[model samples]
Target chain A: MSAAPPVIDRLRARIGTPGPPTTAVVEAGHLKAFAEAIGDSYPRWLTEAPPTFLVALAPVTAHLPEAEEYGKGWLNGGNRFEYLEPVKVGDAITAIGKLVDVYEKTGSSGNLLFIIFETEYFNRHGRTVARLRGTAIRR
Target chain B: MNIEPGHELPDLIKHPTTRQLVQYAGAQGDFYEIHYDQEFARSVGLPGVILHGLLKAAFLGQLVTDWLGERGTLKSFEVSYRGIDVPGRPYRCRGRVTSVVGGRAELEVWGEDPEGNRTTVGTAVVELTA
Candidate 1:
């Protein structure tokens, strides 16, 4: 008998479907820890949210157990961030993530599954703050 | 500031460590074992707990921001991870102006491993403040 529909196909079914909106506040404490972790000592980072700080605000994509079954491990293929407005401390930001695309590619070692997800960030004022697109790979 | 193509941004070198990886994992709320758990990383065909692509993207972001430094605002930035890098090594960040037009500048940025491999590659677009 054929194996249960491959996990890649299972993941493909989720494209264009948004998960849920996650709301979070840009806290100063969290921003400090993130800059410290990155070892970036820029003084302004203490108050302003650095370029990647938004990812720290929320998960870009929901966890999919099915995708985990396909590969032994996961890799971050890439990420793109578009800033509409400055994200600063004390801004209440909400993030909504959705899978944009999923496909498979044959690499030298083996086959790889690529999942593309897009997330849009909005502040309490209802203005879009930033947009993030990331590619997660399973190999 | 006179911006021209081929101008290099000052380099920012980052020394990454396993401990920082854990710290970043907590800060980002990404608990994926591949980033902090060496055993799990090995199981997944990786050399060891590797740097997060977003972390590298952060480094490149700093590269542009440091150069722009109130001179402009970053409009967009992008990065693609081409290879895996482990901790305990210095990651070199570099960039150059690719073009500038109508008060907007485009830059080519990258992060290099010890051997000079462009493990993380990306670009940034910025609007220079008048």
Candidate 2:
């Protein structure tokens, strides 16, 4: 097989892209595990549930072929989330993602590709639950 | 009980390891090779196994929840992944109250490596109600 091209270049070329929305039924086990993993014993998170836990559902939002293609080169740069409402167990959630931008910058380490993706989470009633903006870097 | 502005949360220390990375991947369903396999990670140009961004974010959530006790709820959180957190390194998660308005408290939070490098920086808004 031929050598693969620079992963950053391939991802940059795919900038301004938007992926499809993904939907999943929230289960109590998922929530409990997330709470346990983080050491969060908050009754709200444990009992009533926490809104920020919605992030645990991110991977279910739209498949990114590049994510599979790039592998470890892709780094989670950061994420910003706005919670409009709380998430309860058994709620069917839908999340949509869009690649908002891609750019290159020279850093102390070298050059980096900054990929920005935005995701919106909605509840069963179609009410907006949370909005997440994320940045991933590849060097 | 209400948390006043400037109330601080106890710091949480995490010793990241290959084991934790593996567990995080399995729990979160993130099968990203960089999180586990060292060879795949190096092929991608990473120094070694690195912690997941969500895992670090989860650490921040833990910091907040630990402080808020059992009655609190995390309303929202935002974070910027600043640097790589290699396994086998020690990290500490900390939060400080930044604002309290309308019975809601906002905190500026971050995780730092043993060498004092800020790996993740973010803010969390939490509501305390019993």
Candidate 3:
């Protein structure tokens, strides 16, 4: 009998080049809720969500249908973001994500799959708001 | 408030859990199961649900912002994910002043677990005034 393929193989098969983009409009309620939840009482964040909050609004690899099918062995590897402007309340934002890379590695815990995705956020005027590079690991 | 070059900021502890992950997901509008669903996380090969990257980064940002007080502004911040912030781990967010010039300060920041495992490493620049 053949052994199962590595997690990387499963991820590659599941996550293709990229698919249609998923977008969400930023709402004041969302910002306020986020600030309150995080216990961030700063006026800037409490009054309105910061541009970095756009990361929450932006599309992520975990959102991919394959992500759910991939199962519970995944973890948030890390993320990087470049904020262009302060995100204000009631701003309708749209985000787009694409698979950037996928590879496998051997660690003490066993085999792990590293997945990278790039997401871009745009405001209502179609202006670029921020860019995020998110990484996830599947063991 | 006066922050000199090489000044270090007090560390803040982040005790992550499945419930906090869910709260962060809901608060940040991130419904990604990897954050709250251990089953799904395991399906993906993770030991359990993990904290969000932004949440970790935010903790670092908070350290700088809090030190700078209400009158300061975060001009820019950036960080690289160094390791997994496994749920239930005791994590510490710390920062050290790198430079202070022209009324602006820059700091090197990072978060680590109780075991000294680095989770997130980054830099932040802030403008301070009286």
Best by TM-score: 1
Q: Considering the two chains of model 1, state its CAPRI-style docking category.
A: high
> DockQ values for all predictions?
0.91, 0.50, 0.45
- TM of each candidate vs. truth: 0.97, 0.82, 0.75
Model 1 gets an lDDT of: 0.92
* Alpha-carbon lDDT of model 2: 0.76
lDDT of 2 by residue, A70-98 (tens): 43367788877787776677778888787
Best-to-worst TM-score order: 1, 2, 3
Output the TM-score of candidate 1.
0.97
List candidate 1 stretches off by more than 4 Å: A1-3
Off by more than 4 A, model 2: A1-18, A41-52, A58-72, B70-73, B127-130
The candidate maximizing lDDT is 1
Deviation (Å) of B37 in candidate 1:
1.9
Q: Report the C-alpha lDDT of model 1 over A75-106, residue by residue, as the tens digit.
A: 89999999999988899999999999999999
If you assessed candidate 2 against the hidden native complex, which CAPRI class would it receive? medium
lDDT of 2 at A7: 60
**Candidate 3 DockQ score?**
0.45
